[model samples]
Target: MSTTTREAAGRCPRCGAAVHGDGRFVVWCAACDWNVDPAPPDEDRGRPARVRRALARRHGEHLLAETTDGGAPGPRRDPAALAAYAIALLVHGVTVVLAVGGTWFLVTGWGRPLMAVGLFLLALAWTLRPRPHRPPEDGTPILARADAPELYALIDEVAGVVGTRGADLVVVDAGVNASVTTCGVRGRRLLTLGLPLWEILTPQQRIALLGHEFGHYSNGDARHGRVLATAYRSLTTWRYYFAPAPDPSLLDLLVNLLSLPPRAVVHGVLALLDQLTLRATRRAEYLADSAAARAGSTEAAVGLMDRLLVADSAMTTLRREGNAAQVVRRGTEAGDRADGLWERLVADTESIPEGEYERQRRVGALRGHSVDSTHPPTHLRRARLLSATPVPAAVAMTGGRARAIAAELAATRRTVARHIVRHGFPG
Candidate 1:
């Protein structure tokens, strides 16, 4: 250690080294990268305020067009986007009917059998479809209420604020993301929270994360979630099923030749729907971000997102540090052993000077904004939040309650860490 290494009043829990902070929220140790800290509510100018302010001042006018809260006539009813999926399904049904009835047309010898054969090939593709891909699963240990009552209670408290009654299951995972999804035809709702995300933010930010997720439920995004997921998967199935020419067998060769036209048609339809959904999805993200800001404070909601980016980047360092095969086999127990990885990640991020940190955040925002993905740019989302009215979201879960939630999620986090280290972070 350098002779200049001075001890501070507070020590890093992760590294057992003297840590420093601006006396609130943001905390880190220079010796190790345990930069995670609970954020203070109502204030977070932190060390980067000047840089953020300068950037804001530079882009002040553009902020107005970003719109205030509740103002964006978001694609509440994105007819064009929604219609593409509906029409695609209709076309699929028609093709199914044609495939079945086209054989009779062939018997009449009045029509070419190739089209009928193509239709039949399309139908066969549906049968050969792979199982629907479930929403991203962390494969971590599931925590029953009995195992973590304090945590479940905190969840219920947050749930009340977010306006969802509760979830069927709570999955503890490794990344810095949380999501709500439906599990089965019965529409069982599942809420999964990533501990790395939780570990970095304050109590308020935690609520913001949960609020953002449940916002999906309140905004009817959950309903749309299931439908679109099915649509995407079904689209994928046909794409995969009819994708390749059959093997050289006579029967395979004939079917392969016939499937081509139908395959082309489905490909064209899939491309159209994907483009439409991207727009709808971007709108949905803004709406959800809006809901989260309203449910938690804008600061917390936005901070959660900002810090989440850091956590996400930090998680990648573990790729070379963990045994994927062992984690896949041992689950949470394996994650428990790699507990310090999060600390290491945090330390690395924290060691960077404020200027560099801000630079990186800005560069990341700029570079990421151009991606051909469904979600909107992080900078745009932040801009919208900055322009919108700030609401102080009421949260009953705080202080001791918050700590308990953290403690309860510990075991689940360990297992999730294994899953992440084993399989890697989800995109």
Candidate 2:
């Protein structure tokens, strides 16, 4: 979940201890692990319109509750949001223009040597901008195109259906999610599939999940991702270079104190960009969810989201016990028993909340994401899907056959296993 005021808001209802958050969701009492209910409020069930969704998708969480029943969201032509975003980007453009123009004036018009130092600062910021090296797999298993024709073919057909560009790489990561991203200096497009996430879903649900990622591509979110990523990297790099120096001694402290004003100026600009982009980020998620509903069955899309709630907890439990390497090793070992692998993942995920604390954990995971969250809360996303009036498409697949397909990726799984053992598990 996105960070919320609930972390320090009040006492836990069950235990009455000072409440603390586990970050995404599940505020708890450190003494007893008791928690407040995290589910969407039942009293407010008004259907959300598009403009309202776009608005709620911003920092205001309660705005989602102001919906009228069965009101479909509007088209992407959200003038207010678009205008806000334009204004933000325009602000960024103006900064660039002023910097460039000022630098030119300092260098040519006024030949003042010391004043010309400002141009050097602008040049330094540009030179300090980041360059990409490689796309991160984050310990995700890789499936080569040549080795897995069946999986590649499925991805290809799905991309064609969604009318988006096909991915050059398929990554099997450990999560209850899937996504599309561009990485590497060449900006290679990647399609990431959470392998264990796939195990929890029916074939149709899997299709809907994949469709969700492709939806981002079709809606231009994926393309925008690379651009924003470059900007973020550049900002971070510049911030690091301009930030206060480390204080190991009195001399270092004095240097940082002297540099405070310049650091504050740089930080102010960074914060401004973050504030402006928050709404658009949430809008992108809403749009992608709608695209998923249109490309696949709404039922399947909803089911996939429901599964994700539980899967987050399951992945944590599965990995935290030092079983990440074991899971991958076992996946590669299962030949005809691939169904057993799927069953194991599903059973553990479902059984995560046996104890009181665990139950609290589950409920907490179900709550909404934080303000300025990349994706909206699960309930909000589900509500949007339910409220959307787009035509749903039917998908065909055999469960047993799909299991066989998953089984066939043993070699790639083993490759990931070797990498994990060599570098230590990511978790």
Highest lDDT model number: 1
Q: By summed lDDT, which 10 consecutive residues of candidate 2 come out lowest?
A: 43-52
**For every model in order, what is the number of clashing pairs?**
4, 6
lDDT of 1: 0.60
Q: How many Å off is the CA of 274 in candidate 1?
A: 2.7
Please identify model 2 stretches exceeding 4 Å from their true place: 1-34, 37-127, 130-133, 136-140, 246-248, 320-343, 352-372, 389-391, 399-404, 414-425
Tell me the lDDT of candidate 2: 0.57
What lDDT score belongs to each candidate, Candidate 1 first? 0.60, 0.57
Error at 369, model 2, angstroms: 4.6
lDDT of 2 at 115: 51
Candidate 1 lDDT, 176-255, residue by residue in tens:
67787777676767787766666666678777787777766665452255555665566666667686564568878887
What does candidate 1 score on TM? 0.66
Tens digit per residue, CA lDDT, model 2, 1-427:
1112222347767767765443444555556545445454443322222223344445545434322132334334344445444544544454476567657767675657745666765676465444443546465567778767767766766667666777788887654568787767677778877666776777777777777787776754522555455555655665676666664488878878877786776566555444555455565566566555555677888777777656655556445333434455544633423324445456656544324344443453454442224566666667667765645664445566575567667665555434433333344
